[model samples]
Target chain A: MSPYDLLPRFKAQYDANNQEFSISGVVRPQAIDELGPSIALLRDAIGRVRGVLYVNVRRLTQMNNAAFHAFSRIIIDACRARPDLKFVVITSSVVGWTSRKFGRLSGIEPNITVEEYDSEFYPGQGFLEEGGFVPILRSQTKMTWRHERAILPRHGMRQGIVMADICCGIGDFAVLVQKEFQPSRIVALDHSISSLNYARQVMREFDIRGIEYTYGDASEMLLDEAQFDLVTCRHSLQIFNRPELILKELYRICKPGGRVYITNEKNSHCLGEPRAESIRWTYNEVAKLFGHFEMDVELGPKSRRYLMEAGFEDIRVETFMVTNLDGDPQDFADVIAAWADVYAGEMATRRGDGAEFVARFRQGFQDHIFAALHPKGYAGWPIWVASGRRPQ
Target chain B: MGPVQHDLAGEPTFEPMIQIDMEIKGFVSAWRHCDYVSTYMARMISQNRSDSVRHSNLFSSAFNELLEVAFRTRHADGELACRVSRHGATDRIELTFPCVPEERQFYEEAVSQVAGTEARERYLNSVSGDLAPSREIVLLELAVDYNATLRVEEADGDVIRLVVDLPLEGLQH
Candidate 1:
């Protein structure tokens, strides 16, 4: 018997009092055959609730289609019974919304509400649990950072210029543009099939027309160069092992006088130590790439420097300081863990204690680098944004 | 029996009950500015269930508090009224309100102002002094229905609250 069988207890408690209910249990995959039974039990549990059911589906990094189907059947059945039941579904990370089948599953039921909870939901670096923080952060960030910063500024009527969003994760920027700008055409490109599927689903739900979602490597995609009026590479630049090649592609695709906005997380180089050397190396490599192109550049103090070095002209850089100490200690710990995981490959071969060494060094980095550096007791990363125009 | 309190029980006189409920529901649904009102209401209604009459009174009071805090803050002339009546073992709360023609016109105008052009541009300029240079104004038009109801059914001591006729509309102004 799987832990999903325990859901009946939760259902009974919920029915008896209608109190806000929470179920915490571990799911072990016994075999390929056992997966179906486990999913059935979980679905049965979900069907018992009539009110708002917030399903936190975690440990889904290894979930396959059969597992997803099982989960979807349960959700579909629940929605069919009580259309008013609002289902809030959370996933670890969503790769593509426009191309993935599961991403489109939210559209299967009008009553089921699905949203991707990524870095925006966390206070600083914490994974948000139920009743922990506000659920609106994901929506707010999309409006502020993705919409206000990228989409709203560039949309217009009768403009021949089209937009190509490289690595359009979950179609946040793409959806905002399609809905707000009503652009002549938009090509949303992402590497993950799942993210593309979700993006497509959102577009369908919003009834947004004339947007195309493509699933392929943004760098290798056979797109016509100089066809786009604007090329946006939001938060996807650094992930490329060879960012220089990607920059070359961006330059080739952008029309003369067209603009490119690149945003990334700035590694802490303020520590003035071995960790600082690694940060400096990363920035230098990025700068060398931009030097090849004849464009003006602006360098932000944080992650915004890479755009300046990429030969972008009339560059603007903005620095955003975010702290991750708003919630419990465990939340901060989780953030540290995630940070370590993200940079583990790079941090492992370096010197001592891996990320912990870098983290500890960051604590005293300001004192060594800048006399004016304020030493506020907090744990968070600083993000930098840089935008530049290609010369005509 | 003395005054019959404006009795037109069967006259079918445009009982603003559905209209009022719909207006409140519309206001709540139109703007995705808050959480689900039914969920919040259910919690409040369940906690205040001391007796049938007291439960109704408390439900009415709590519902009004939610109305004032959530909907009244946005509109200047917003009105909310609630009446509790017992039908045998079950109790129903009916909310009513007088129609405000000016406010309705104001909303229609506001929607039109942001219709063709970027809606966010107009909204930002109206609300905040700073103008964002971006022309892309993604405006999700608030969905407002003129008739709706929130039914709370009690079966076997389990209270199931359902928000009916919740009109969902998407507008890009």
Candidate 2:
């Protein structure tokens, strides 16, 4: 048996067609001899590939000195041996160490280059994680929290349980959970550095303790299995192209018999008075707009099927509407205004929608905002809440 | 995020966080001990950081290097104590383990070399060199890559204490 088989925490794979060799997981072998199988695999990959050989370590969580030295030697030696071939080492910003460590190779050998793998995993991440969108996120959370604060208890949230808020955008929900539920421990993780930084700043300002705001890819988190008693991923599934992968990860981290909670929106269900037809037309377009980006904004009703397919048991699902009546009317209006800016302004423009289509799309959101702020009018945004237990 | 309130001495002081005391023999017996101890201590202390997971990963990697060095160099029969303390953005990891004369000299020289002007050059060479990985590579990493302050001194009798002050969270770009 190979040394890697003995220590299964590490995995190495090579795709010959792409000429890419990817390494993932923790690699902390005590001696360089133990890395023989991996090094051999890399050597073989190098011989077979031409042009550029991509060494991808976007998911490598840990690498000790012994492993680093061994890997560096192979790259440095290969660069000298194959002067015609270019080597690009792909690292992840989320992993924190791989970029700096592997980046040293680019300085040593001109043939070797280092590239931090950007957010190719989430197609819509850029539009959502921008600095201008942060306030909208906070307002959206504030609007949803009013309904969720009451609904969470029915879905297995309680004080003193260990919890994690995956894809915890700006961490407003985490702070609310910390204050309301008082989880003994809360690890709020997100892929956005600016969002995590903002979360940390808010924590320090409020002097709130116990929430660990961490940077990570929710699809493949480094957290140990079965560690959290309750794992909450709210209103984030619809943002990802492949949410089933995220649900699989949520299932992995959640403890057996523990619950994984999620909330998502079905944009077409959005309703408003005094311009109901325009609002409905625009929301249906909103769903299609998100679909153009490979996102499923209509994923709310599908949560139960996703949960069941992910092997979760005891699934419970509920729907709630965030209306202007829930809170200050202006807050709801602000959310609609921001959505108009993003969905119609940025997303629609990016999708190559013409001036006429953009005007109609923008009109729907404006009408929603108008309905929200009008003295006698009403606007409502529907959200689906679902939770499933990891089978014991 | 808040205004700086300096102490009368104008030097920031460390507040004790957490520590682990174990027998050197037991620690050195298994390689996994280094991984477990570093990961646990890192998780416990990184809760309040700007990015706890990133901090924990960085802290664990650096701390594990120290623990591995101690595991390789320590005397077989003595107490091994690992303590982590923090002051503002800086985290200090102090590792106390029993060592013989040669082991003590090895660490002292490594610490001195890390303090030299040519430390980064030496580190790059050591890590990239075709020879077997140098034992001092860990110290060089903590010094050059992490910009950590390294200090070593003789403790009780045969014990040597290695202190590494790492402002890891603050150093993130």
Candidate 3:
């Protein structure tokens, strides 16, 4: 009789190296009840044979609070006895809407890991399981430090240019444009109300007004034709499923001589630091699952050509090698870890090897942090700032 | 009952029932040129204090056409009464017309006889081109939901009741 008899649809097995253990399929509380003790015994024995145990639960269909707590206790207690051994829980949220929105889970020690991967791989440094990775990725005060600073100074964001920002993620870049550039008026549109709510909070924090924020599809804007003086999307263009339709829409809305400023990464380099390499490797795999809407990820690298294809004149592309190490190396790791987890859950549903790959890849992120803190730790991240002008 | 929704910062949320009951005095009052009664009702339904953007936008669209139908019919006097209420958290726009008693059968037939899928599709394809959507197509399209209806509930005199109960499920964001 198979150990997962009660959970006929599920499978729990060890990999070739035993460094990674995977439990996949409908992982309900009753199923966990049947399999929990054997898994706990395996967790206890894991420390004796291997220095690490990567628990890939990314493919679980449903895990209730009690089952999650029970499994968490097993890992936390086992890791408690063997301080040198590490236990990392890699999960995917793509199973369903309610899946993977789990509360933070960790072993008693600080080094134990529980990573919830978001499908959209926004930028981040790695994370330490100890603090449960609640790092604020967006900051209004320190807005100028990242990619936007490279494109800001040149433009005359005069008092009369009606601007529109599509996919204004959390409105961080839009706020910067409104404050620094000072356009006459801006209409920010995004599909997600939750994100816009956060953006509205940020606007209140700045005490600024006159921006019209609404829920709209970027490709099919509800606004009148050629109404905007400028249109900008930062770190958001690559995520659209129908970029061609949207790019054409952007072209249609731009006023003569007005520009469309779009920014996203063509290359994400972490100074060849071992840790940075690990995060990027994991990021690339996770991004493959949900990031594309029916488009290629190659679009980010070839945005200049896409602009030309979208029929924009006087297209200009700028590559800025943004280099900074002001933050702690561990903080960098934590941020990257946070970013890595963004898609693990979402991707698990796409591939048969998803849970296993997510765990192995996260271990790579852990190794990157350990190596990045070395004396030679350094990283260089790149931002491709592409702009095109509507014909005069 | 309207879908409960949170509001923008500083903007207040909507009550389950609107405090002020709105009355559209006459069919001519709404359809006579482009005037207050239509605009008033549109604003009330569109800017539902509830802040349910999807519900407000979609419901207002269907009601505008329905209100237009209320007038264009023959017996329509300027005398009309409309109450926007919620059915236990369900958002519905209820309009009662003191229609010309003679043409009551016409409005009744229009509501009772709905076009089928092919007829509805043909109706849509016909009037889809220009901004003009025919009365038949509009009524048929609204009936697809099965919630929107026109029924002649003859009481003291003969009065036509037009109820558009917008399903929150169909209102996809």
Q: Rank the candidates by DockQ, best first.
A: 2, 1, 3
TM-score of every model?
Answer: 0.33, 0.92, 0.50
A156-199 in candidate 2: lDDT tens per residue?
Answer: 89999999999998899999999998999998888877788888
| Best model per DockQ | 2
lDDT comparison, 1 vs 2, better candidate = 2
Tens digit per residue, CA lDDT, model 2, B1-173: 23323344875767778889998988987788888899899989987777777889999999998998898874778899998888888998889999998989988998988899988888778767755557677888888767798989557788899989999977664
Ranking by TM-score: 2, 3, 1
lDDT comparing candidate 1 with the true structure: 0.42
Docking class of 2: medium
lDDT of each: 0.42, 0.87, 0.54
Which segments of candidate 3 are over 4 A away from where they belong?
A: A1-146, A153-156, A182-184, A197-208, A267-270, A274-298, A326-331, A343-350, A354-360, A367-376, B1-60, B70-173
**DockQ for the candidates, in order:** 0.02, 0.56, 0.02
lDDT (Cα, 0-100) at A5 in candidate 1:
43
